[model samples]
Target chain A: MKNLTLALAATIGFLHADPLPSWNKSDSKQSIISFVDKVTDAGSPDYVAPAHRIATFDNDGTLWSEQPMYFQAYYIFDRIKQLAPEHPEWKEKEPFASVLKGDLNSALAGGEKALLEMAMATHANITEDEFSKSVADWLATTKHPKTGIAYTDMVFQPMLELINYLRLNDFKVFIVSGGGIDFVRVFSESAYGIPPERVIGSSIKAKFEIRDGKPVVIKTPEIDLIDDKVGKPVGIHRYIGSRPIFAAGNSDGDYQMLQYTSAGEGPRFGLIVHHTDADREFAYDRDSHVGQLNKALDDSKTQNWTIVDMKKDWKIIYPEYIESTPSQ
Target chain B: MKNLTLALAATIGFLHADPLPSWNKSDSKQSIISFVDKVTDAGSPDYVAPAHRIATFDNDGTLWSEQPMYFQAYYIFDRIKQLAPEHPEWKEKEPFASVLKGDLNSALAGGEKALLEMAMATHANITEDEFSKSVADWLATTKHPKTGIAYTDMVFQPMLELINYLRLNDFKVFIVSGGGIDFVRVFSESAYGIPPERVIGSSIKAKFEIRDGKPVVIKTPEIDLIDDKVGKPVGIHRYIGSRPIFAAGNSDGDYQMLQYTSAGEGPRFGLIVHHTDADREFAYDRDSHVGQLNKALDDSKTQNWTIVDMKKDWKIIYPEYIESTPSQ
Candidate 1:
């Protein structure tokens, strides 16, 4: 009888030591565990073939905090300032002048077009190698405002655990983001364990040519594809060539991707990361300008998507900040 | 001593049974084997990490045969005829009329523009699901003209062995083709063991919308992207994100892809399948109307790209035809 009690205690202890240590033992966490268990169990009807076990995650708020505007926006703002010296007329220009003058809201008042112009100016017309190096250099030096930590160090501990868990279960995880492809690719592998090839995101047209006695692929300012909202599903179709079996996102940008994935003819899972912690992390949902979760939040209940409330569902948020490799 | 002798003789006989039975003992085959060995060997300075061991192959002439016009061109012609009763105006059209009248040469005289019109007509303006179904239906019934065998059965045996060998060495093989994305995806898995997610090809634009109380992504008639010539490298960049380490093709349409791949840092490989066997397969290059191999053929020598002479290198062109499954 003592031996039986000891065995039972050991089993209970093992069960409590779950894979997602940062996630609180909530129903949302349970749902993720249960779904993974069902899909991985070969004896169960939900068993998916290893090759088809694909899971995609949105990179911005879903993987890291997107508060105080997108981190890439800050990069673009800094880029505008850097280019201002070359463009002497920028002191009088509307968006560029405003950006250089430290008025971000006015610079963004022109909406997507202004943002796109900034993205094009900063992200294109250079060789692919130069752009990659610039992104890596920026990521190495940039820090989040509130946390005063490197942007890469602001990755969610819970999401990191989830990625590791999914990979362990034979799931090939992909980063499907609205951010620039190169921007996301710069640190995705180091921060999220997702390699550059598996990342699907917005792109600018690139031209392959021989120049200066060397073959080079150059990124042009022309927009090639967008991977947001309705475009997300289209991007997934074009890049992945198949719908993902699992998807997770934080905003309406990922609504269509989740719809496309869940609509597939098999058991699937969708997650919405709800920002609900005001102390540890900024909390905003319906009214937030950046990473707004409105339509997706409204439909999560109807669609049976797990709404992961940050305050309630997470025992820990970001990993302990560490700038391991200093490049710049 | 007799038992040991017998064992030694059996080991020697097994070793003599070559892995690539359809490939003759030629320089091209030796080059492929040697390159793969060097890259895969852990002790070698040329060793590449498993995740970076990407290999891309062109579909048409490189994998099978694209002799008497592309197989997809025949499918488009058949589709034009099948839809003729509905669209009576097609009978008076130059390209469509020529296609229906069985004058393939006159039909193709209109060149790329004419082919684009047919592709837009038959391959788009329907739901993605419907388009995929139509491709599958056509491939299920189609047969090669000379072999009278199912098109899927015409896959090259040596290429099959090479694919298997690469997979064994942890290389992720992808089909980077100029053919229709949905069309290649249908047979890629069954014929080559490459899943739909790994196939990258040309695609028409698709948009997501709600219809009949169900959401569906519909294929639009507008040409979204082409995956040939200079566009091949663009497609590879937009889909794979990372440049492939190894690339293979058989025509000028693949020139940019091979250049982009081989230009990358490290021990890269590029291969061109030269169609020199007129008796077994069609042989036309430099001045050929279809699968023209002009500039690429000339550049291969200077670029250090291995050119596989089909007549001298391949002992067997295609695998023995066998349709294991009946058409739907």
Candidate 2:
């Protein structure tokens, strides 16, 4: 009788518990909950089958924090620095020289061509294992410039709760990012509970080769898919095949993905994480060089996409804050 | 009391049941079972985590019959015939002219270039929905020229059982096909119990477009990925991210994938389905127009890969036979 009573109490507690605990009681939170509820409810007209309940999230800003610059850019810069002694030509090169001088803006000034050159030099001409290990090592040792926190710890607490909530409702959540596919894959599973296969992102060409009687996949300098802007939806179609019912992103990079998600027939949801909290997290939009939220932010209103104001909607910024703060 | 008895009996039956009932008692069957058992056993040194237990199967000859020609090729020819009225110039075009004359060999004589022309002409320049609907319609109406069986029905029953068996043992099954990614995605779920997202294959470039206020993905003529030969490993890396522990294929196309899978530092299993039964199924190896099993066949001896001789290993071929032959 005691066991039965305890089981009942546990069930009730679970039923009443807030899934997104880090999310403040705001319209953004309410909209997300309502959409999930309606779609998951079998009796509702907006009901979605579990098989079709795919939720894709943009990585850099949507799931985690991308401030000052993308975390991947830091990785690239660091990688260039590490390999600087070997490549003497890089000291005088446009992007590499700028990167070494700690002038990120000047490095980026050379545009996509320079970025691709650096990405290829650092990311390619090595086995997939070696590249993965290097990324993993860098992430383990690297810290954000201003926050002084480990790069992985900078992930949004509210977004983590949202991902958990989605998964609990049988939604297969995926990270569709502009970041390197291989780079994100290393930490996706450990950080977000998303397996490597579930993470889709920009990639360079790679080929299989036999080295010392063992097969190894070598990353090539050639650019393959660029999972950004217009390429987001293309990546979704190529990787996922099926259209996602729900999509979340930050900045104009996510515009096409949200557009594609909302365009699908039946009840669909699109979410945008608008960084509005300057004190808690970095706040720059419209004119921000990295993760600029201009066209997506403006169009969110017309598209009926739920715009998440970080200051008002999220009670907590990072998971570290939750551990530090005492519960009432 | 009766319900309890039935439940206990069901549990016992499940524990002892032959997962691959279609597979005859052979070395091939034993090897597969042994590998799965060793890897799944918690106390065993070779035990693999469920997360890493990925199994990839080649779609065409590995999962279904690709005899006479690939089933997708048939779809292409039929599509060309249906669209011929719209393209009068196809009457004089080299490949198209041969296709119109019902000469498949001549149509294919132009090789990959000719095939791409026909594929793009029929397969592209339409919305994804239209293309999927057409594939569905074709499969529903069409029958194999030789066996008069529906294309989907031509799937090997033993392979189906093997896929199910792996899934039962906590393996995530994926279809890595040389066929068009979009083409295989249509029936992947229904035919092979593999979801669209889990199916990786050759693809054409597509872009998201808002046509008449509705968002639609339009397939373009541009080829994006060719998931064959060395391309197989590249596709696997790009999509799966992690190397599969278990890999199955029937042709040289899968050679690289198997090589990659086996080279991984773990207990791995590679399977080659040798179409050695001309009476039951078409037998062509070393030299075949489609799904040529040459180098892989020769190297299998050294690779320790289990080669399934169709005649000796499979008790039943297609699922239709199982229905016709009633259990004693």
Best by lDDT: 2
- Reference-based TM-score, model 1: 0.91
List runs of model 1 lying over 4 Å from the truth.
Answer: A1-17, A320-328, B1-21, B320-328
Residue pair clashes in candidate 1: none
**Fraction of the true interface contacts (Cα pairs closer than 8 Å across chains) found in each model:** 0.48, 0.78
Model 1 interface CAPRI class: medium
| Angstrom error at residue A17, model 2 | 2.3
lDDT of each prediction vs. the true structure?
Answer: 0.84, 0.89
Q: Give per-residue CA lDDT, model 1, range B17-56, as digits (tens).
A: 3556567777888788778889988999999998889999
Candidate 2 chain B — worst ten consecutive residues by lDDT sum? B6-15
Candidate 2 docking quality: incorrect, acceptable, medium or high: medium
Using Cα atoms with residue i matched to residue i, what is each candidate's TM-score against the true structure?
A: 0.91, 0.93
DockQ of candidate 2, scored on C-alphas against the true complex (2 decimals): 0.71
DockQ of each: 0.55, 0.71
List the per-model TM-score of the A chain.
Answer: 0.93, 0.92
Second chain TM-score per prediction? 0.91, 0.93
